[model samples]
Target chain A: MPQTLDRRRLLATAALGGVVGATGLGSLAPEAAFAAEPAAVEPGAPDPNFVEGRISKISGHLLLVTGSDTVLHSIRITDGTSIWKLHPTTFDQVAIGDGLYARGVRLPDGTLAADSVWVNIVNLHAHIAAVGRNLLHLDHKGQRIVAHVVPGRSAAVYNGTPAISDLSLLRVGRHVQVLGAWHPDTNEIDIATVYAAA
Target chain B: MAAIRGEVSWFCCGTAWGPCGTAGGGACGTCRSGNYQHAWPNTSDACYAITHPDTCGLSMSRRTCGFRHYTTNLCNGSRVGTTIADCGPQTDLFCGERTCCGSACGSNRIIDLTPAAFSAIGSLSVGLRPCSVDTV
Candidate 1:
């Protein structure tokens, strides 16, 4: 409770550097930030640096997660933890029953000091059934997915190249892996990054 | 066989969300989205006809369902063990595609993992990573 008050006070007084920006937000993306940190666990084993499951409970900055095999985990979200739902958001935006995958350092007390959390994030591989202006009609497996390209924010990486915003290279009948945030209970998604054939 | 150098991505199988709802238990019939399973491009003749990895000059021996293969994300040291549960990745569509991390690089789509299997090695959002597929 006291910590909450202190955080609120800081938020009210501090000049926020994070803005609803006009450029690529990859630098602020949690996954990229955490991706460099090598996993301390054994290969093919559960990575201590990552967590995945449904939200069982949220208490202040702590989140209780029921992972696979009903393994329960506690996640401590600090100010440093970048939470990306569809886009970068705050701690309050998280709600119960929402699925999440988190990457961070595991504290000695069995709590994960989260560096980042992706809520309802999905990665999909599909073919470009069609393409409209800033819109992509995806055929994932055999199902259709309507992926919206968020202007300025949405970018594409062609065959491991540096990301670029110009999607004119996106042609029909091409395969692509889309990185985006899923719309709750819907088939639509807001694209953040697209990895595609050049 | 030696580890095949290639790129890897993930797919949904079994009962899943959104467009993945239509995804059944894959070609193996034992596939599940939550299991450490994968889709191979060379599962059968018909499957090969669809994926056509050979069009890229990559020849793979026939591997049946339930065959175990290990995939290592070349970007990181993380690896995962999965069984063949489906046929996919339509390799010919993007024959010369490649992805790399630092000095290590891989080309062509050789493997497709289930969501459960993929999240084990790398974040789902960073799709299409360089990888090595092996049997051990």
Candidate 2:
């Protein structure tokens, strides 16, 4: 397994090198030397336990949502349901207009009895325009976004390597992807992880 | 048969924190935020029923645990292959949602990758990117 991983990493590195060379993005550097093997699946099926959308209405423990596809979903929150809004929170923390992704069981009435819910989670690909004491200026497409680095929460993965809490390896002018919780009504995000080439 | 084109996003699992504390390793039980893994919309019959890609005119093949799919960021052509660690992206939920870069555009949310996997191809803060999913 280790040998296979090494070979894969080497190939990935070569591929990355080719890309950087072609694009002249000299600042993009490889940070790790390992790549994971792909896993398999059956094909042509759907997952029945997950839901994602914006909270259109919240009444008691039930949430009325309008999916990105315009599908309507009724999600039920139970005592065992875990709701997250930037962190582990309660049902009360969920509000209208908040985006949500839920994983749980679908009841007979079509309501998703959620087991876990993540609110305002966003994953974006952007260029690291600048780096500050504890924040990063990112340019996604044409929009400038501010990503706050939470010391204990923020992590980085360089060149397909294990995640670490270090942010020093990150460089400005390099392209990076950020996984974070969106701060509602703002262009700022609380970063959970920064995927960079190092 | 061919590549599946759509938008890609990221999610957390395993050592969950804050809002992810209750995320518990995904529906497949092996999902972790640090691993090179991803969530597919079709891992089982039950899962398929929820994320029915067919609802949006997409005919996704049902793939179970450990199924590998290569996701390529359409913008930069950067690609990463990952195994299915859980079920996700609720394809129908975000059916018409689109992500784009330059002139390249991808619509719908088809896959949710782990931090380890997503970072391999693109930055996570950009929220979403147009991508192509293939089995190679």
Candidate 3:
């Protein structure tokens, strides 16, 4: 009984602080975050546990998605599911036509029981052409991308260090990887994290 | 060859759309966003002149287009094998930058996979991942 109680406490903390923990998952196993087993995938193959597409329909907790290749998917959100739309958000923030990437388990019925879903999320690699007071101009594959630094939301990771909100370390002409939510049909993205070399 | 420790990211090519710019078949004229492909820092003396992984203290070999490499996402132990389809990931820019997944860690930007290859082992939302590259 005591063990179960402790597990619940740990889960509660994980629920609120998962993304804040970044890629390491903060000591929590991917299995610990959800009850279902992830679909088995061969090494170097497309992960069946992951899905990416645009939400074409939303009915209650179910999301109908159409992939960029026109593949269809049904994702079910649970109480344990974490949603992000520009920021950590709730289910209501999800809407039609929003692009999404989900990580979860595939149920027997082919429905994805999502443990986490990032709507409008885009990971971009580019050069920091210039840094403005609260914005960044990025050169991505010869195209310019405008990145907005959100106060209290945007963070930076330098030289493998833990994430910090101070973007001072970012420099022009440096290569960087930016993780943010795309502004949908625009060259703009609201910065979530910028990983750079110091 | 021993598995090289480094950072792995992704890009688009072969008429890819949205944020890919005019990537257009990459440097090899065969890369596609849907194919299992990757970009290596050292494809030739000319390509190496640009990426210069050695500046980051890495002695990567000149593996040209069509070469196969297996990449593992250290964050999750997921692995994927891809053919070299481009020359890229200017390593000199982010020299000394590193990332890790628990005890497993890596330094430098060594490889760039396609959307099909990268999203298979890791989430696109994460942008970059600590990785191990080897021939399997």
- Please list the residue runs of candidate 1 whose C-alpha ends up more than 4 Å from where it truly belongs after superposition: A1-90, A101-117
Worst 10 contiguous positions by lDDT, candidate 2 chain A = A30-39
DockQ of each: 0.19, 0.05, 0.29
Among all windows of 10 consecutive residues in model 2 chain B, the one with the lowest summed lDDT is B14-23
lDDT of 3 at A45: 41
Q: Residue-wise lDDT of candidate 3 within A108-171, one digit each (tens)?
A: 6777777678788766778899999899999987889899999999999887789999998789
Candidate number that wins on DockQ, 1 or 2: 1
| Residues A2-58 of candidate 2: C-alpha lDDT, one tens digit per residue | 523233223233332322221232222221111122222222123344565678898
Q: Residues B52-133, candidate 3, lDDT per residue (tens digit)?
A: 9988899998888888898888877777788888898888878988787788788889999876677667655567788999
Worst 10-residue lDDT window for candidate 3 chain A reads A30-39
Order by lDDT, highest first:
3, 1, 2
Ranked by TM-score, top first: 3, 1, 2
* Superposition error at A57 for model 1 (Å): 6.0
Q: Which stretches of candidate 3 lie over 4 Å from their true place?
A: A1-49, A104-111, B12-25, B28-37, B44-46, B64-66, B75-78, B101-103, B114-124
Q: Residue B113: error of model 1 in Å? A: 2.1
Q: Over the full model, what C-alpha lDDT does candidate 3 score relative to the true structure?
A: 0.75
Give me the displacement of residue B60 in model 2, in angstroms.
20
Model 1: which residue pairs collide? none
Best by TM-score: 3
